[model samples]
Target: MFEAVLVANRGEIAVRIIRTLRALGVRSVLAASVPDRRSLAARLADEVVLLEGRTAADTYLDVEAVVAAAKATGCEAVHPGYGLLSERPDFAAACAGAGLTFVGPSPETLTLLGDKVAARDLAIANDVPVAPGAEGTTDAELAEAARDIGFPLMLKARGGGGGLGMRVVANPEDLAAAIEAARRQTAAAFGDDRLFVERYVENAHHVEVQVLADAHGNAVHLGERDCSVQRRHQKLVEETPSPVVDPSLRDQLTSAALRLMRAAGYENAGTVEFLVGEPEEGRRPFYFLEVNPRLQVEHPVTEAVTRLDLVALQLAVAAGQPLPFAQDDVRFEGHAIEFRLNAEDPWRDFLPAAGRLTALAAPGARLDTGYEAGDAVPSEYDSLVAKLVVHGPRRRETLPRAAGLLEAASLDGLRTNLPLHRAVVADPAFAAGEATVQWLERDLPALLD
Candidate 1:
């Protein structure tokens, strides 16, 4: 393993990476922005390279700055945790040009998978199921494609994730406006205004497969995660060994994921997302959504069940080490759930809230956080404060424990969505694993009431 590596992001994910680096006996160098100079990640890192900016655009997203930090710090690789520039092909290329390894897929793979249209085409070519979609670069093309895709289709940006630059058009009359709006947003977000249309599946379960590949052409899937409970297409809760996915469906999903990754010559960790529609005539339909070409925010849930340190694997793969185990060697032990504790109030339209955490405590659960009792949550960047991961032998036994852990824990100073999580755990629908992608938004009032 490399002696030192640079952590190219912030928040709890940065802390998460540093912990794994320490365990693997690697020195961690953090490229921190001005606001995170005194943060938890900065404190835990073996060294800190100040990015000298406050906002994300000026700091974490600065490709040149991050790459320079790694060079100046004498680091061999850079680990971009989740968001920011984690999946940017340009970022990976810059690292490569600087003679530093990026702890993810290659730039060519990133470029191929980053574009939604390209990824969809790859899935189709690899015999993986994909939703009916068409790529369009102009308004006329999109409008024409929308007709073929039928009404109630989704207009999505060709690049980026986290629900940005996406729209649902229910009628032809609104297609023009939605196209203009999505293009503008996509241009601003991803610097690419290319758009596509896909048939939207209503009340679908958002399931994803976690696949790991090495440079030696070895690949294996840890399992599947159900992230159906979402708000505005953003996942709020995730669990491994989806309550609805049986062994047969599991095999199909994992096999499809491995096939696509191998076809694309992918390496390191990536997630293949799918939309599973309700069963009809003894058959359930699943369509490929997109591939997240980085370590996800909900990766802890997979680790909880698989007993694998994904960060270590990422580093080892980047260092040109072959995978130590094959598909048959991997094992799943139990059911695991992860709740994203965001600094947002679920009651007031889920608006982001920022303040000092005056009191914080979680007695007997795996809470991966970046703040302590006296830390302040800044208004900039993502509102996620921490991730609460809990594992149990089965889903039946996990729900009550998760609910009790939330009820017993204390987090103060800012409004949080703990109340909503508590409600979901206790709600019969969620406990029974019947919640869909739209369930959270459609039933928000009932959940928070």
Candidate 2:
């Protein structure tokens, strides 16, 4: 096991990683921005390094500063909780150059999977079905390619996530402007201006597969999650054992996900996302979306159903250990759901909300968070303040538990997406197991009205 690990991110994920590291007897080192001095993770970790800035660029994303801190603190490795430098191939390569272990996939795998277009081609080669559109993210020949792919398309940023650099073009007149906007956002967010055009599907469902691999050339899928309930391309609610997915579809998704991971020589925890279409020719179909190269924000739901500690698995894999269990040894016995409690007002177009979190008490099966009452909710980062995860033998048993959890929830000082989550749990369409990508976009948008 690594003797010491540095957490290179902020908010709930950092805290979550520290907890697991502490249990494994690994010293946890936290790096905080000027305003993050009082963050929960900083307080909870064994040691804290105060960086000299408020902006992420000034601190967390500053590679030299982070590596210097790691050296100064004598941390042996870095565990990028989820975002920030999690998928940055350069950072991983730098860590290797510095003789510091990066607790994730190799740099080659990150470079291979981090590029969306290239990954799509890799997917097709591995027999994974992909949406018809876009040559890839680095397709510098976009206008020519866009002209070929046709309008009513999707303009996506090469280095984008959480839907930052994505735009839908319904007409030829909108393509150029949409592409420019996506390029700008992608550049600002990812430092890469690569863009691509792809065929856009209307009203699709978002499903994801969680896969884990080890150094022994073995990988296994932990089943599927339906994260179709989203706002602005960001997922709001995630559930395991999608009610609408049949056993066959689940197997196909699982098989393809494992293939992609093995082909990329991926290790540890990663998510393979897909877009499932609504029944068009009387048969519902799914297409590859993208792969998140880190632990997902909703991984607890998977843990609840599978009874596995993914963070621990990551640690084991990073240390070059084989998986303790085989593919068939994994079991999925129940349905699980997780709701992201963000400090955002859903009715106001889901704008980011920030302020002191005066009070917070999660009400689901289990609550995971990095903030408590009196913690400041900053506007700079992701608004997710807490996660409410619940589990049961089936969806029917789980639905009521979800409703009660929401009703019992209480948060103050910061506007949250709680009410929106409440509405979704009570929504008849959602309750009847008929949620699709179009469900939120077209069917009354079950958010807080």
Candidate 3:
């Protein structure tokens, strides 16, 4: 391993990476913004480099500043712990150009999978199923493609993820206006107005597979995650051993994900997401959704079940080491669930809540967080404060455990979705594993009442 590495992101993920670096006996240099100067990650890191900006766009998103810090620190590698610039191909390329190892996939693989349209096409070429979609650079072309794709289609940005720059249109009358709106949003969010249309699956389950690849041409998938629970196209909770997926379906999903990664020559840890349609005659068909080219926020769930340290694996892979085990050597234990505890109010349309954490208490479950009581949550960054991960010998046992943990925890000074999580855990639909992508938005209000 390298003597030292720079963490090019902040918040809980930065702290998460720092712990792994410490365990590996590597020095960690954390990049911090003005507001995060005294943040938890900064305190945990061996050294801190202020990025000299206030907003995320000027600090965490600034590639040149990050690279300069890495070089100045005499670091041999940089670990971008999700979000911010983790998925940017240019950032990965720049790190390589600066003689620093980027602890992720190659820039070529990132470029290939970062574009939503290109990823879909590659999936099709690999014989993997994909939702019917058309890519276009202009309004006229998108209009023509919309006619072919039919009504109730999704407009998506090609350059970014995280449910941004996406919209649904139910009819042709709203197509042009939707396209224009998506264009403006896409340009503003990603600096790329290129858009595409895909047939929407109204009743779908979001499932994804975690894959790890090494530079020695070896790849293996850990397992699948059921991420169907969502609000506003963003994941709220994720679990392993999907209640609906059988051994056969799991095999298919894992195989498809591996095929795609192998085709792209992908290395390091990544996630391949899929949208599974409602079962038809006891058969559920799944289509490729997208690829997250970095460690997922929900990775702890996979770790709890698989008993593997994903961050450690990432570091080893970036250091040019082969995987210590093979596909057959991997074994999964019991069920695990991860709840994203964000500084948001569930009752107020999930509005972002920011303030000093005056009082805090952690649940009995495994907790990964960046802040403790007395830490201030700034408004400019993501509102996610912690990830609550729990595991049980069986899936049924985890529900009550998670509910109990949420009930016992205390959080003050800022609104959170803890109540919402409690309601979800107690709901009959969620207990039965029947919650779909739309279940949270469509059925949550009635359940809360």
Who wins the TM-score comparison?
1
406, model 2: CA deviation in Å? 0.8
Off by over 4 Å in 3: none
Over 28-136, each residue of candidate 2 has an lDDT whose tens digit, in order, gives 9998898788999888999999989888889899988888789889998888888788988999998899988888899999998888888888999999998777654
> What tens digits encode model 3's per-residue C-alpha lDDT throughout 134-187?
988789999899899998998888989888878889999999999888888878
- Cα lDDT computed for each candidate against the true fold: 0.92, 0.85, 0.92
The residue-by-residue lDDT of candidate 1 on 1-449, one tens digit each, is 99999999998999999999999999999999888898989999999999988999999999999999999999999999898999999999999999999999999999999988889999999999988889877799888888998989998988888898889899999999988888888888878888899998987999999999999989999999999999888999999989889988899999999999999999999999999999888767899999999999999999999899999999999999999999999999989999989999887888999999998777788999988888888887789998888899999898888988999888899999888888988888898889999898888888877
**Model 1 — which ten-residue stretch has the worst lDDT?**
276-285
List ranges where model 1 is wrong by over 4 Å.
none
**Candidate 1 TM-score, C-alpha based:** 0.99
Q: Tell me each candidate's TM-score.
A: 0.99, 0.95, 0.98
lDDT preference between candidates 2 and 3, better one: 3
- What range of 10 consecutive residues in model 2 has the weakest lDDT sum? 134-143
Candidates ranked, most accurate by TM-score first: 1, 3, 2
lDDT computed for candidate 2: 0.85
